[model samples]
Target: MVQFHKGFPLELGPVEAFRPNDIQHAAADFPELNFGIHHMGDPYVDETISIASRFDNIFLILPLWFNQYYLQPYKMLHRLGDALLFVGAERICYGSEAFIWPHVQTYIDTLATLQMPDELQDKWGYPEITREMRENILGKVFARGLGIDIEAKKRELAAA
Candidate 1:
């Protein structure tokens, strides 16, 4: 999985920033590998989304992006819409970026309260984020990317 942090090119400087072309080449060359771009490519969200749309193996990790946008509920709705419209919910995953933020509960609470605006719902043709989709983003999707069978793991834990 690819973890890119070039979204803040201006702050990090052009030299440190991740280039979209690099991602394109990697995705094209390694079609069989799952590519996960962290921070959702931050300031380059649109470009990341565009790149992800082209490669089925590409996934956007919602770590810093979630914390950054969750407070602004409207922006969250639009961001979610763009992701859903382009790559679908299955191609996205939630990331805590724990230790760095060090406040897991705050992030959890924020996500718990997130609500998609009615206008965005109408625009995206969905009433709201469903429980299944939420589960997928929070864990199932990432588990799948890593070739982990979450259901089987659950069964094993239950049997134990």
Candidate 2:
């Protein structure tokens, strides 16, 4: 579990915690290892994205942001859209948040029905969120990253 961001109480420390800058060195030093940044460095989303743009091995995980998505639907959707547009579906993954299972269901449902609005598409060149792209983000990409042959594994299990 990668804990890039924290909800640390800000009473004692003068400096902010969970800065993505702190993790940049490790990512730069270890190019072979893949990094799934939790919370996408929350409170520093843009910085995380900037760093991820530089490293191909960096992947963005989306489930932890469910609360933020519930609170700010459009803002979260746009942020996700930006990530999908910039990083491509191959570098994003989705899963349950454990605490908010129903919210996650809504999140998935929302994503399933997602479409790039015409104005946003024309203005920003954001691609339409096809079912295949969604599937890749949901699990296929992570399975590929882990070197898992999902279909073969399924067949093997079925044969057992």
Candidate 3:
């Protein structure tokens, strides 16, 4: 339930702060609840990444601002490396900070260097990105994570 933004940093300021300790407590009490963090929780990228690594119920979306593309490639790679190694490919999803900027594709393209998992990226990477990764990012993980019967549901909905 916390939304941490970088401009204000440590202090939540006007924004709500949802600490992991609190999240852990809530999950312990109500194990059925699903927790999701958005825009990598803005300025709390490192902390958010850490939480995703530790919690199975916690999911995150990577949007533009948190990508921090302006930083050098090595710095970007290092942070991205931590995310992939700790969070696992299935737990992470890609999203554009669309409407904030028109050329959001450039931001997503920066992931080129992370060399994400070969299974996540296409054979050659870049322009040739495949349907498998595309499906995973678009909705496969979400459907599987939520325990939805994707094929059966799709068929049922289509017939209705």
Candidate 4:
């Protein structure tokens, strides 16, 4: 589990193929492993959040795809927001999953445009969410979750 988690890169898509039982086994084998679940586990945000909360080894990375705006009628973002709260921001990281530099900028702008309630914003450790939170979402939770001890990793990355 540690080898897999250490070796796996963020470019990989949502970990839908990984079952909870597999996670449980991995956690049992390596309690210190950091397993990042992406996009709220693709189509199962609630279950993904639940799994994150249930297992200390599980953490979440909020990757950009369809912004909160594209969730349609707001149901999708609302469900995602609710689930995100359940998992708490400290356990959540951020990513754009952008294919290029321009797409990365678009993701930054999109995140800035997202309107979040005060309570949620506070939980996210920001007065209000902006593209700035991207850094925190990228490295903060991940650093703490994995307890990444390498000084080099810490120097190269920022923590929440």
Candidate 5:
């Protein structure tokens, strides 16, 4: 899996930041690998969405985006709408860059409070973020992407 973070281009140094075409080419070149773009590619959210829409193996992880939860919620919501509309909830997953930002519970709590506004939901033609969708984004989607059978694992643990 490949994780690309272009949110802070300056911190990335001379790398010139990540672009959608880069992911497009990589996905095309290596169809077997799963690609995950972190922070939903932040400032490049639309591009990320576009790339994800085209590539079945590409996924978006929400880590820094949640860290900025309170600071810029509207922007996050906007990007969330675009991603949900383009790729559906199954292709997106939640992540916590906990090693760098240790307040993991705080991020989880903030994410729990997020709800797509009714107006935006209507505008985007997507349903409200249901509990099932939230659960999928938090774990099921990622597990499925990795080809892990969560229910089977649970059953095995229960049998232990």
Candidate 6:
């Protein structure tokens, strides 16, 4: 797996690197390789989703976008909804950067209680957050993607 911060454009400050539309060529060029787009390309969520949706090998790591939960949680919910609706749970992963780990519980808490508004579901057809979906984003999806046996890991950790 290869991952990059989409890091570029200093004028944009610390939000994100804008859009990731230009990544298609490399993704197409390397069909057998997997690409994890960090930050979910922030304001370019649609673009990120478009790329991820088009390529089975493309995935999203959510540490940056997930930080919005500490500032504007509603926006995070919509983004989460969009990711789930467009790419589904399997491609979404909660990436806790080292700095983010200290406050990771907040992200976990917000996601734990995250729910799409009823009108949103009626209007946008976004799926309501379910326990199974929540669990996947928490780490299950990443573990499964890496071919890790979760039950075995749990036992191993317990024994430790």
Best by lDDT: 5
Better by lDDT, candidate 4 or 3: 4
* Residue 63 displacement (Å), model 3: 1.4
- The lDDT per prediction is 0.73, 0.70, 0.54, 0.55, 0.77, 0.76
Tens digits of per-residue lDDT, candidate 5, 1-160, equal: 6666755465646544655558888898999988888877766778788999999999888876666657777677878888888888888888534337466777767666679988888886756887887887888878887778999999999999
TM-score of 6: 0.79
Show the lowest summed lDDT stretch of 10 residues, model 3.
Answer: 1-10
Enumerate residue pairs that collide in model 6: none
**TM-score of each candidate?**
0.83, 0.80, 0.59, 0.59, 0.86, 0.79
Q: Deviation in angstroms for 147 in model 3?
A: 5.1
TM-score of 2: 0.80
RMSD of each: 2.6, 2.9, 6.3, 7.1, 2.1, 3.3
Arrange candidates, best lDDT first: 5, 6, 1, 2, 4, 3
- As for TM-score, the candidate ahead, 3 or 6, is 6
Candidates 4 and 5 compared: the better one by TM-score is 5
The digit string of per-residue lDDT tens for model 6 on 1-160 reads 5675763344747544356876777789998777778778866777888889998778788875677776876677777778889998888887535233577666678777878888778888889888988898888867765657999999999999
Q: Per-residue lDDT tens digits of candidate 1, residues 22-133?
A: 6877888988888788766766778888988999988878876676564676776677778877888898887534427567778766655666678777776644677777
Question: Candidate 2's residue-wise lDDT over 1-160, tens digit each?
Answer: 2434432224676436766676668877887766776666667778777777787877777766746766886677677777777887888777424245455467677666767677767777777888998898778877776667999999999999
Question: Candidate 5 clashing pairs?
Answer: none
lDDT winner, 2 or 6? 6
- Given candidate 2, what's the lDDT at residue 71? 82
Which residues of candidate 2, in runs, are more than 4 Å off?
Answer: 1-3, 6-15, 96-103
Error of 5 at 39 (Å): 1.0
When 2 and 4 are scored with TM-score, the better candidate is: 2
